[model samples]
Target: MKARDRDDEGRARSARPRDGLGRPLPYGAPGVGRQPEGVVRRPAETVAEAQRLLDDGMPFHAHEVFEDAWKSGPAVEAPLWRGLAQLAVGLTHAARGNTVGGARLLRRGAVGLAGVDPAHGIDVAALVRWARELADRVEAGAVVDAAREAPVLGGGGRGRRLE
Candidate 1:
């Protein structure tokens, strides 16, 4: 095995460490690296799958799902998915106590989602509203409970398809 590769314990010596929010830290830093495989772009066929991940307190994982869609879905829908991913990452940051970063990402995500069509299986207006509100709160230094404030994809009722 190479020096930077995983050892018998399955730990990669050269893996970039990450903080609780799943953001990569400096190499050789004192923190655990998130499992790399979970970020693979599978491109969820339905928004419900991503919603479930968010509801389950795994926004970072949900971000990966949205990211997959952004990377592989229809070209026109990339912005929507990218926005969702940013929203998820913002929530992740909030949960990890990075209020400033959380607010910034939430605002950016809201901006990205602002112009998405509502008929595209997501309530774009509602999402943008929620994101903006969350961003404001985070910016005001509010301690957000991620689980309680987790955004639901495709709205609350009637599941929506991504394709």
Candidate 2:
């Protein structure tokens, strides 16, 4: 078997490049740059960066941002971060045509975020609503345009919404 690529810490990791939707591509093929993992950032920074990634139609990358928060941020906030990560992955799946996976992840994410107090302008209620609605629509045979329909994460006076 071919040896797996190892990260600097020597853990095996995929060296394959990935597409915009985070699909693995052939080695040596040009692909989208990946979001660095395990970055420790302030809550506001996390939300800002995540919003930019989502606006850029890179939900998979956004998920990485949320994952970092979930892993490194305050324990009390883990669920919100984790839910956001799942929601991003759901969008990724939907964009990639995995309806079942998309719907499942989306619902799971919404459940994770349900009733969480809004923190750092995350607009938890709006996000949960968007995730649930999108999942329902996608399951009912609606096509997903992840980028165009990406939710505007609250911050900078931008209201929470999906358009």
Which candidate ranks first by lDDT, i.e. highest?
2
Q: Residue 48 error for model 1, in Å?
A: 1.4
The lDDT of model 1 is: 0.74
On TM-score, the leading prediction is 2
| Candidate 2 C-alpha lDDT tens digits along 52-98 | 88888888999999999999999999999999999999999998989
Each candidate structure's TM-score, on Cα atoms with residue i matched to residue i, is 0.72, 0.93
Q: Which stretches of model 1 miss by more than 4 angstroms?
A: 5-44, 155-163
| C-alpha positional error of residue 161 in candidate 2 after TM-score superposition, expressed in Å | 2.0
Q: After superposition, which runs of candidate 2 have C-alpha atoms over 4 Å from their true positions?
A: 156-163
lDDT of each: 0.74, 0.89
- C-alpha-based local distance difference test score of model 2: 0.89
Model 1: worst 10 consecutive residues (lDDT sum) = 154-163
lDDT of 1 by residue, 41-109 (tens): 434354766777667666787787787777777788788889999999999898788988898999999
Question: Clashing residue pairs, candidate 2?
Answer: none
What value does the lDDT take at residue 113 in candidate 2? 96
